[model samples]
Target chain A: MPMLDLISSTGVAPNDVEPALFDAAVNQDIDALHLPNDADLSDYLDALPRVKSIFVDFPAFTDGRGFSLARLLRHRHGYEGLLVADGQLIPDQFAFALQCGFDAVRVKRSERERHTAEAWQAALDAFDVTYQRGYAVKAGPATSIFDARLTAAEANKTTDPFSA
Target chain B: MYRYDEFDAEFVNARVAQFRDQVERRLDGRLSEAEFRPLRLMNGLYLQLHAYMLRVAVPYGTLRSEQLRMLAHLADKYDKGYGHVTTRQNMQFNWPVLGDVPDMLADLASVEMHAIQTSGNCIRNVTCDPYAGAAADEIEDPRPLAELLRQWSMLHPEFSFLPRKFKIAVTGAPTHDRAMVRAHDIGIEVVRGPSGEVGYHIIVGGGLGRTPIIGETLRAFCPKDELLPYLDATMRVYNRFGRRDNKYKARIKILVRETGIEEFRFLVDEEFKALDASDIMVSQAERDRIAAYFAPPEYASDIKALDLEAQPEAFRKWVETNVHTHVQPGYAIVNISLKDPERAPGDITAEQMRAVADLADKHSFGEIRTTHQQNMVLAHVRQDELRAVWDGLVAAQLEDANINLIGDIICCPGMDFCALATARSIPVAQKIAERFNDHARQQAIGEMQIKISGCINACGHHHVGHIGILGLEKAGVEFYQVTLGGDATQTARVGDRTGKGLSEAELIDGIERIVDRYMDVREGNERFLDTYQRLGAETFKEALYADA
Candidate 1:
């Protein structure tokens, strides 16, 4: 009954005694907020400034509501904290989990028996090019193939005046 | 037709390697059936009743001659020598072994095709009007936009594990909705704004499985660059809020129905406003680059003559049924009838496929298009070479001469193949076609669509047929239900159910009786659906159960 977070390429354990401080969280005594997979984020949008970390649950891996939850927390609410994916997710979903803005993941001990952190990292490195825009790239600023094409087009325009 | 650039080519090749690795893991003990099921389905491999079925995406229903020949090669080598064209503008090989799928995929990748997302709970293969570029009524070809969406949704992270499968359809023509955009999850229509700005009219939450619902307009007009972001917002809303408690009620249509379209629109708008699309929007250069691949094929402009006077009556009938007007002069879009009475609708043999591929290279511009009605189209055939194409089709036994006629039925791979089917569909379609196979009699019936689904899942799109048939199992015996007056045109509607279910023999008789009823009380040149609408379903209901 442990959470498997694949967000960190080099896995991270759950912060012990962290999620149980809801009362303290209400009083601005804590910086983390743990939410169920279906937690309504509208009520917490006002509290995002106080909260530094959001741990979204994936009750089951088949329930993908958490992916959108993480996306909304990051892109919409502008939450730049440790967005942790905590649940039963496989290594195959590592790339997607990262693209959705999860900085760390907690995997179940059972799943870790066969799939190690290295396997998850390998899975993350499988795709060389993705058509999405929001992932934290291995190197420079986050950009899709379209952005790269735009940059190249601009470079060509500068070099070859007649290209336009 | 859109040609694959280096990016697309490399993307598909990488996917082939990935699928090969996944298959190897499955064959070993690394992945369980429960774990491997979704992965296999994402790659369009389904374990059906008989064997593994692989559905290959025909992106926007456009295929080059080499791609068709590759499909034929795969069918002959790895399948049972035939392929079935699906309603989603895909080709399904129903007999591929699990081990051979990766090799088959590699072969498809060589021809710039893949089975990715074709049968998964994700954004599926984007379908468009089969007559997109050639149709005279089109404002602009929707294939560029469709291609853009295809790339955007491929392996999309947050939206990949949707509650149910998502389908998007696009159409450029205002009047001729061959893509059935109104009945899709997200139907897009290309439109020109007041000042001549090209944009998209977006519709959301329409689907036709067990519950058939027409999509409501979400955005009247969104700028071209805003298409992907708008879609990202809508998908985020659906993924976050769609019901997962029940599998049947999990489609976006159900969500839109349960939570009103107004609320859904508000949620999407809020998300759209929040998401920063500064770097995500499709750049003009990228759009132009993609559009360039779809430039008009070189066509003979001076050839305006067609010698139909010397042709036989059968060939003339074929021209009348299968030929459609093109936007360009001296060119016609030819509809190849896959609904030959001798074979199942949409099922093409390997030899027939090769023949069609050769015909495509010779008559058309080495391109073929698959329609939602489970037929193939040569979208750029010249009028002068129409006779040669007709002759080639005749040699392959594909000259059915019944494009929109009674014999042209759309049927699903029912209990015979599909694991989800409750009763058989192909036999019933074959029987009905046999009863109404007369060429002259079929012409007399006029333009009618008889769509049959083995179960209420409605893969055959029976919900929108002029004469819809749904097969069910009652007391361990097969029974059929008849529905009337459905249309998938600009005016989309779900068919109304008639009397109780009938047996196989009685079902055929019932349809004949219904046709007889239409013949007796008919107006000139009125379609079967129009006739049924003029005289209500109640009249047909009475006529059907008069002797019951």
Candidate 2:
């Protein structure tokens, strides 16, 4: 597995701290926790204080439950610690994973070989603009098309005071 | 009718470039078919039974004359010779080489149109009442809202890959559900608040595939500005909790069904509460900007009402069947039927497309609308010019005068083109149309919807048809099952299945018998659905199975 930090746009060496499964993490003093897509965050609320890293399993790239889980952890339950997307994911999903609050993606060795690291980096700049706001990327909060339009409108207003 | 501004233009061009690159990658073996399928589908390309099918999104079913001309060009250049207007109010070119799709999309981009989100698990093209601005009883034009949602939902990173494809429909008229709102994943009805401020009544989880369910009311009144946040919240809930174990149980409807509407509402509200409304709230300025494009076109003040009394018998009948009342004085909405009994329903030739574009420019303020019933509408046609428009349509052979008659059918491209179809559907629809081909008989049967689907996917919306036909393969033989009393209006209901499947030979006769039985048992002035509602499905079942 190779870890790519989308926020930094750089590849990082895989960490030696293996994520403990839900059952083991519940019983043991594990700093890194691994949860399935269907893992209820409420059940893990007690363990959140001790866990420094959380790995959400995607199972398959098409199954998007992990994206929501990551968002729920960051925005809803306010889990600010490291969140890693683990399992089958393609380069096209790197930017979306980042937007959904995943700090890094741990890609399978096979997928990494198929889709080079350059491909993953290029995918980040695939679309310069997005239509959504509030979602975070490595840069900062996503700037929506509406936000850009509003800015342009404001700049025009300031430049031409007489124009309504 | 909303024209793309610089931002929209840039976004679509960028998307086209991305898709082109993806296609090149797939062709050169950098991307495998397993990985390329979802990507291509997101761009509205599908590998059908024949060649690739490219569905171009006609956002809110509104198109300009120039856009229609572009579609005509695409049909002539890329397809065999025609395009099919689907039940979702999108246009599908059934024959396009995989290599040529990128170029086809680039052509569409020139006309401010793209096929993005027309397919795939992402939110599909938002459909709306074709008669939005013209309908007499409309509360407000739903196109602005639809356009806003379209922009917000496109390329939405978080909700792009969901458990299954999501569909949304909007209806402005309180009296009619012309968009088939209640049969979609999220149905929106424009409503006036207590003080007459426009808002939306949101319905969640209504769909018509394997399991037919009318959406339950999720929100009584979602303020106009809060729509995106609310929808974002709903999508988040569905994406997170919707089942992924089985593809069949993956739609939001199943999630809503399993988790009770009450709990689902709680979850969505929780997600909505976490969202920052200002991040995505549609501003008043942006709202007005979109709405300005949809403002009613100027009309002739001195236009006189149409006097059909002295018109030819055929023209008068066409007006009686195809004309709909418009809000503007001396204006009418003209429905151009694509159902000719000779051609597949919704299939229109490129020549006819150009003719429609020309006619639209001359008679309908250069605007055309595609309907859920696979028909085209000239939304703002002056009553005085309708005769000329009718004449033009007749010249083009696009004038079928079967707006809601038995001849008007909504059918999917079944086994002839769709790879997913278990049996043929278009031939059955053609047979039914031919059997009742008489103008007087069709008019007498009156306001019947015969929707046919090749498989249980219900792309033809057979679940909501008045006389629904579902074609299936039983023991390697084609079998047709009929359902009765389905409605797609404000009071949406799934049709009840009648006993026994009929062979292709017996299907038309069974339908004819059902119609004959309805004629026998119906009260005066009642439509087929009204009669069915009064008499129940058992009566129709008896009629269908009597000879068997």
Candidate 3:
């Protein structure tokens, strides 16, 4: 398979693939156009009109900015595009990807495939659904002034005179 | 003690679960260490030089007896059977595995506790006085405001990530216990205005790093009600204008320095007007509710101190060394020194946690505090119970009786854990404390505080120590520099560096030389600081290097 490596922000995939290439065959892009490990959510928020599955870079796991980008693209912007993590993308991110809305992962051919696949499946198997707002996180009753005012508004039929 | 409501309970439980899931993925190799790192970090986990360290927040340095016991449980179960109290009033476990952390966090959550936001670039734990409610000199208890900030910043959408870490300290008393008005990213100190109304004196940009700055005064007087919004303004100005180009220069302290305090204040004031000040942010009812939670519990007005017909000389020494006056007339603030003579400074075992909790519940109110100097405090014990409390504490091997003395040293975990540290600090602190263990000799030496930092980040509160010792690596050899007559008291000042750094062998000898000089020159048994003030640094500096 010929890889379209993206080397920089201004660069694009080496091969001229049609938008149809996403489902037809697996194509890889390199560091061109400076896509992140987590695909650019803001860019993805715009129409991908041409590319479908693009490989993003993780750089490293500690670089959570990429992970966060993936989350925004999948959960908030609601991008259904196929996302494959490239570069320093570790299998650990695969589960977080699944949570963030990634389907498959890309790794070196020399990588342990079976274990990686098992871990990815385990991550998916772990959680059931998207949280309205992360059901798993502990909720604080009194969070914001707005939250308090809203709660107050709900409690008293009398209108809150001091609404923020 | 403020018990966690359902909301508090739920928040911590879910947070624990999230971190647990993240940890499992890391161990299973599903998540790369890079991807797994921030998740752990946001949850207060850090992979340092030796192993993973989890810094659990003892909010505003306040913890209930049961909450503290849980910390002890984690110490026994997952760590090296001990935890180190940090300068920020948090506890850091040196050895924790990536796998057992979720369970550790779960244990923490069961007691309405957490390790959340203890680190990372987000709002770190809010710090207040170790003696919050009962301190004699306080204008008001600072815990409620600390809690307010905790809620306002928790998982805050915009500030979950910022240019750099933010630190804020608060104090209610006339005497600064929290170092509140220092050069914090933001510092809050209570002051009485001409109207005799107690209002916050806001300070900004005071911090220690590559650039050490004392916070510049932003507001001489701000009403208590406007605090959150006022803080919102300060943060907004920082968020909009703070330097994002350099992480080191990103603290508010740098911004204030460059813009100048007057200009910075002008910018913050402008932002304050634009912030969400509508009833949504802080309403009367909301304030009342929060205030209700923090309302002082009524005490038995006539409660008398017990008759201590016998006061052990040891108890007297401990009292002389450790205890302080509380705001509550009959109560005393007991400082429990964690710096043992032979052991590492700030290392407290799980059993010790239970012991401290027992002391809190039995002798004092059910509250304990962790100080910025990495010591513990039993905040409101009746003076009458001092002997009994001392006896119980002594048995736990906790009554080091070295508070504020030369032996009560503040030392950081240097090369042992902090990858940033250039030299070992614990050994140096331990060595100094051991030298000063002779009570009479220590009295002769006089009131002195020794603070040590492995590196220059000043996490050990070294800058403000009366005898500040900064450990630096000189040609791969650990070298120590001593600073004379600094203080972290109500009126805090950074110490002046005396001269050249000393070698490890010569470090203790250097301290001894300085002390011996003070003893010789002293007109009385006043502190080293008083004598230094009376005689000046030239005499002490000359004495330190006289043998050299």
Candidate 2 lDDT tens digits, A1-164: 23574323243323323333355545455556778888878878776767777878889888888988987788777888889998788878888888888888887666766788887777776776777766635442245677788888888767666675
* Pairs clashing within candidate 1: A3-A106, A4-A106, A4-A107, A5-A105, A5-A106, A5-A107, A6-A105, A7-A105
Q: Score residue B96 of candidate 2 by CA lDDT.
A: 95
Using all chains and alpha carbons, the TM-scores for the candidates as numbered come to 0.95, 0.95, 0.79
Model 3 stretches astray by more than 4 angstroms? A1-164, B28-30, B178-180, B301-309, B523-526
lDDT of 3 at B81: 86
Superposition error at A77 for model 2 (Å): 3.2
lDDT of 3 by residue, B79-184 (tens): 8888889888899998988778888888888888888788877778888888888777788877777787776666553355455788888888756555445846
User: How would the candidate models be sorted by DockQ, starting from the highest?
Assistant: 2, 1, 3
Model 2: reference contacts kept, as a fraction: 0.57
Q: Compose the digit string of candidate 1's lDDT tens values, residues B218-255.
A: 99899998988889889988998899999999999999
Worst 10 residues of 3 chain B by lDDT: B274-283
The C-alpha lDDT values of all candidates are 0.86, 0.88, 0.71
Error of 3 at A2 (Å): 33
lDDT of 2 by residue, B397-458 (tens): 98788998999999999999999999999999999889999999988888999999999999
Query: Which pairs clash (backbone N, Cα, C closer than 3 Å) in model 2?
Result: none
Task: Tell me how far the alpha carbon of residue B290 in candidate 1 is from the true structure, in angstroms, after superposition.
Answer: 1.1
Off by over 4 Å in 1: A1-24, A139-143, A154-164
